[model samples]
Target chain A: MNPSDDAGRSGVSRRSVLGGGAAVAVAVPLAAGGAQAAPAAEAASVEPVTVKVTVNGEPVTVRVDPRVTLLDTLREELALTGTKKGCDRGQCGACTVHVDGRRVLSCLTLAVTVDKREVTTIEGLARGDRLHPMQQAFIERDGLQCGFCTPGQVMSAVGMVQEGHARSDDEIRERMSGNICRCGCYPSIVAAISDAQKVMR
Target chain B: MRAYTFTQPRAVREAVTQAGTDTAFLAGGTTLVDLMKLDVMTPARVVDINRLPLRGIKLDRDGLHIGALERMSDVAADRNVRRDYPMIAQALQLSASAQLRNMASIGGNLLQRTRCGYFRDVSTPCNKREPGTGCAALTGINRTHAILGTSDACVATHPSDLAVALVALGTHVHLVSGRGTRTVPLDGFYALPGSTPDVENVLRPGELITGITVPRSMWAANSVYLKIRDRQSYEFALTSAAVAIEWRGRTIRSARIAAGGVGTKPWRLPAVERALTGRPATPDVFESAVRTAADGARPLPHNGFKPALLRRTLVRALTVLAESR
Candidate 1:
């Protein structure tokens, strides 16, 4: 099966159902005039923008509100929840994803701004059933504890290695400081990245 | 976050024309989007300026000309910047996280607001957030507040580490609008928080930052940026110093010093620079020169340590630069 077809198959049905329910919810209120009518009237006026993005080598087009973040769009619209949102602010690295081959915090990036860019999320890292080398190394080295920050850690590690700044352990730690593991899995994470460095090369 | 219209402008003229009091220019959306989420900044329309042809890094006979839209990570990783302007490179590298650095532009970094807790929380009384509201940071938690160029209306410190280096190296900020183009000294670009704490910069309503030109100087080659933070990485500076000095054998010909995290704006130390000129590059001279750094500092209750910290940071940066020679 094609990757884009798989993504579209999962996204189309869920969104259509949600869209139908939302339209009914808005219609019923507008049909009945009350104090609740004002908010529903305002909701109707908001223009939805169609954004075209290449996700995981798949061209995914979706209409989202301009306020929706790239992180929310990936998780909610495309049903790719591999990218977690730790802090909606840019402070945390949990929402890290590759945009045009560079790492960026998706929570702070607007979905519409990345119109036709290539976005590679955690789900995009694997090749069929085979896990990425970073993912394999993380498991081999026990690089995670709670696993909440694991996806971001793996993504950031891959980006760090690709940046070629993590030549030594100290440099690895410094460059990888954006992603936090509150479970104190620093040593293991560093070891896994160090091991993956050789294999990735 | 309030819903707003996002329009991508292809040219500088369209972007400036679209900008108004109720509109904002969005480039690399790191700071603007964060503030919009926090409800600190509410814009009816956000003009996307990323598509404008303002992204370039050039080294010419004048000096280094960096586009305002250049990413912080790209600027830091530039070979010319790393070799010739170590202070700028170090400052850019030491700012924010790697993810943020990759997304944030140089222009957005300069225009980033303070990290004051009250300013970010919309419910609180912050003069910066809503002018005429009382400043909660004045008597509340102010450990990270400013000690220089501060007034009763506001005390939040400028948070850009890059601005400190730019100001120290005598960079020129190029501004363009429908009116025309003009250049301003980066040092004087930031407005001091006097009675009007809301007006943070000298930028007009429709003006756009085109790029910055850093003049090549003998001092730029031997410059250094030292930042003192609570953590080793991915943290804002408690106090930072950017120093560039020119030495003739054993004597100092000229010096440029600027500090961050302790001033309402990027604080330039002309007095210290003057004190170092013609002076021998020695520990005693550095100590005496830095003593004048806190000449007009008005320390708050929780920030009494900042004046001392600022002086120590400058001394340390000067010591490192001197030792490198």
Candidate 2:
């Protein structure tokens, strides 16, 4: 059994869960092979952990399982699916979101833990339908191939620009390494980021 | 990923009181959550330790005190840390990714589990996950496994570049349990690959890492991390070196050296440090000192590149550090 085979046996049968190493909460269920999907913990069993999340400048209140992932909550409950889920295991950055203005992988975060904090997803990157500079640059530069890792790349680029990490190509590559473009369109990706820096400036 | 009770304690005392035989402290959710998804770890109850008021970054006489809850990105982005402690910042920056660094905590990085394939697979019997079940890596395809400090039981390398840097910085970790708070040298955190490969760290059950402290010295300002992986970014190290040395005239005042991707833990090369202590800051000296990187190395069939790569990384890291200084 190779490492990949071992990883495959660990609930990933087809794809190699590689890319973002952290921020992936892969809750596929326990090794209870025959155990029916445990019904969502009932309200009675659920702790009414009041999570006050300030999302994209708007304060919102929601009741969540202490274990509910920020990714699923934002997508399924909040109807914000712009943050796609390529590899739910945090190996892919498709679900990257911003926690307090810093990019974080939503799939790996617990909703209850981020209570009383600010959360930002790709859906919040725009203002009145005007795309963010990074998003615009990506469109103009064709940074994406299949558009799966685009949202994450865009979010990360926005973060890099805001954080002043877009000074050099090596830095851009080091910073953007978290988002994987399966199409191997890294040259365009870097170009888009460089363009975004100028556009945002 | 089986649904387990998520317990958030207001304090470490309460959290330790709540931990049990089947309980696991959930930190950063970077490593633990992924394992749970694979059914590799099943803690009936998960005690979320993030909200325990254990977050801060401070520098004192001993070293830098990074609370376990301090996000990796915060440390990397901190102006003071970047100015005074470049090695720590570089280590944190060179880890997973910006998104990951933002979510991952420094304490959690220290406690990160191995990236071995068998341990993550449920169908396979990984001695690390289920002791005595047998180590599949022995006969299995193990390209990313360790090439140093390997025993027949297990040979997994500690994966954190931050840890490798921490070891080189001579950092000590502070832990809090129900009993009291105490500090342990980073060198003692990881256990040797003995029969019980299932166990990883030296911390007792229910012990929580509260903070990591590194000594304040000129060496920290001159430290650097050089990781050689398959890809330029977002990949675990094929081999890496963290070198923090202080030079006085031509003699070395102090030298801290450690390597990743080739050890059971973030290997602190005291041999290399001893070799470099009185030597001049030159390439030949660096080469001779680093040649012992794998002195006791026992490389598997597929990992022969490790010893040589480790040497090259050592030279590269030293050059980078010397130039930065």
Candidate 3:
């Protein structure tokens, strides 16, 4: 059976859906298990562009389908799952990461666009065992419950402080509005950011 | 998202030349990528124009020239935009979230599609998304549908707060294509949803927006953008007013006003502007002038409150502008 037929039923084919770095990990196992194998003709049809990106101070080269997003590349490809994907759409800030020193929704950022740019994920914040001020502040303030949104919240707070918008509690709440803590940890999150701001400065 | 070949053009000329009927110029990727994932927009060729040098904010003797590729947050934070064009700055600040504002470009923000639920869901019928497909929002849940500019075909509102401020300040959009360059007033750039609801803008296929110019004026410095939404932040407006007033002594010399979340396009209110000109800047004048806000408004079943809301929002904006100065 052609993979396109599966796409006809599901609106997306496995061959076309494997744009994330996790594609290699997921595809090889399935192929070895003899579950399904993408035909060489279908595989050769896609043109993967090579991109040289600096992620977390490490220089890396990745060849990805143009459709792959930065969030998928980090989580699935590079296995840097520290940056969580809450909503694949840009609505949720769980996929937030710093591209070129600015906080942006990695889910909406195409991997090709980040070529030759510096991307700092949540994993990059700590130096060795010493946590970034924001990370330590979140722990002290009990800023997280389930901690799914912690990485994005911390990353966004760091960027927000660097942008000089985290001056007051009200301002911190307004600036940190993007990262939604579904566990209702907004007060703690705001407190954490406020605490981190002084130390980070 | 659909599979498509992507190209990064170093020059604007090369980017324009690469454009075709089935090609899309990617910027920001907020609206385009979101829509593409829903299969609403399926372009065969995707052109990444991020590498182009269209990112700058310059003010000359003419006016404020904002490059098309400038990010929303960067433009909002620019000294000139914050100091001279407060309405533009406030609009950008109030739109989306911090993350989106950082990623979204000014050029793509103007061309963002409507927030109509019917248009977003491919399962539903939207004349704007698919022409000849009957509009589900016409008789469905349309509490957020447009009231000022409603046609039988579509009733979706234009979702840009910045465009409303830009239109009120008399901004001109700079466009460039393989054919050449031409400038169009931002007010006239958007097409009304009449017979062809699918055709949103006047851009010819492959045409690109280079920059926008807002003519410097004393009134713009006193401008204010007042948006009333269900939520206090991170939501599209139920009714929004962008008002700029030029005061001469106690009376108004000139007034520039535009409304959002009530029309198919950023609506300039010349009638309201006429009511304020040469009149004393008072609460009475603002209330009476704002009454004409819903003069020709055609309200749907659920959106009957918009006209009243538009009037109140405009009055509040005018009052705020009057009081602030």
Candidate 4:
């Protein structure tokens, strides 16, 4: 018998067994059945959670699903698309944002959890249309190629400098290892962060 | 992620009372939120414990007392921790990324699960993820699996670099439950995967980790944490060692050693420590003593190099510690 059939015969929970290869096959039929039960599930599951957060510098209130991550809330709800989403998983630092002046992965942070905390995204790095020092340094040093990971790199660099751990080049690279630039722009990124540190100091 | 009701508990008593089989206490949400997204952990209720007054890091006359809610970055950057317990700082610095270090809590770091690919992917049959389901890492891509602690059920390595250092420092975990407060040695906090792979720790249901206390010792000042990994930064250890030695002039008075990434839990090397006591603080002595580290190791097909690597890591850590001061 197939694994799913075997799983069923063994008295395992369907959801537990559905985690395997047969998920796709089971999901289609499950979705059809779920559609009939959608209204009831939606009423129970989609209860909006209200959260008040100070994004960038402005305090704002938003009602979102409890499952909605801070990254999704920032990009979709607040229209702060500067914070990129490379890998929705916490592995990539593409969704790095400062919550209460500390860098954290936005994809892993539930929006409801950070309810009264101050959040600083990439868009918050400037003062009235003037580029932040790190952003200026990134441009001057050509710290980015393709520019997808640049926002995260710049934001993480800001956080790193604030944390005071980037005293040397090796330290800078180590501290900034979270933001991965697959375009092989690491040398330039390090250069940008180094230059930004001098100005920041 | 499945929809779950969230409650913020203002007090530790309230958090403990709210916790149950279907509930999970949220700290940094670095690991818990990630696992929930993968559907690996689907707690029906999430109790936010951040509001609880458990964030303290102080070096008292007795020892270093670290609150459970203290963030990893804050603890690593603490002046007392950096001066007296350098191994703790080094281990925290070498873990995950800077972003994660800032987000993860000291208690949450100790409780972080394995990074085994099979356990992470819900589609696979992982005994740790679902008991009675066979472990895929036993025959699959298990280069990162444990060699020191392995059973027929699981081979996943404990992923915290900080835990290895804490175990070496002889840290004590203080836990609080509705019943009362109790303490367990850090080495005894983790459970080895014997017949049941699902149960990873000895924490009772509704029990909360209040803090950890590391007793003051002269050996901690000379401690070092050496981690070998695929990359120099932002990668988990292949075989890491945390070594702390107390030296009186040229003779070693006492030694403590622990290994990570090669064990189901943080593997303490009492044999290696016993072998180093009274021996002169020399490279030859360190090299000879570390040989006993792999005595009881059960290396797997893909991770046969771990025993040798673990030994070399211990030697390197000891050498660094001996050379310092």
Q: Write the per-residue lDDT of candidate 3 for residues B1-325, one digit (tens) a residue.
A: 6567789999999999999788898999999877876778878899999988898899888899999999999999999989999999999999999999999999999999999999999999988888998999988999998987779999999999999999999999999999999999999999999978999999999999999999989798899999999987788999999999999988899999999999999999999999999999899998898878888788998988998899999999988888888
Using DockQ as the yardstick, the better of models 1 and 4 is 1
After TM-score superposition, the amount by which residue B7's alpha carbon in candidate 4 deviates from its true location, in angstroms, is: 0.4
Give, for candidate 2 chain A, the lowest lDDT window spanning 10 residues: A28-37
Would you list the C-alpha lDDT of every candidate in the order shown?
Answer: 0.87, 0.80, 0.88, 0.86
Task: Identify the runs in model 2 with alpha carbons over 4 angstroms from their true place.
Answer: A1-50, A57-59, B323-325
> Model 2 — TM-score against the truth?
0.89
lDDT of 2 by residue, B155-266 (tens): 8778998999888887898988788889898888888878887777878877889888888887888778888889778889989888888889767788988899989889
Worst 10 residues of 4 chain B by lDDT: B316-325
**Please, what are the lDDT tens digits per residue for candidate 1 over residues B64-177?**
999999999999999999999999999999999999999999999999999999999998998888999989998899998899999999999999999999999999999988
Candidate 1, backbone clash total: 0
Please give, for every candidate in the order listed, the TM-score of chain B alone compared with the true chain B.
0.99, 0.96, 0.99, 0.98
Candidate number with greatest DockQ: 1
Give the docking tier of candidate 4: acceptable
Q: What DockQ does each listed candidate score?
A: 0.41, 0.33, 0.34, 0.32
Per model, how many backbone clashes are there? 0, 6, 2, 0
Given candidate 1, what's the lDDT at residue B77?
98
Candidate 2, position B218, lDDT: 73
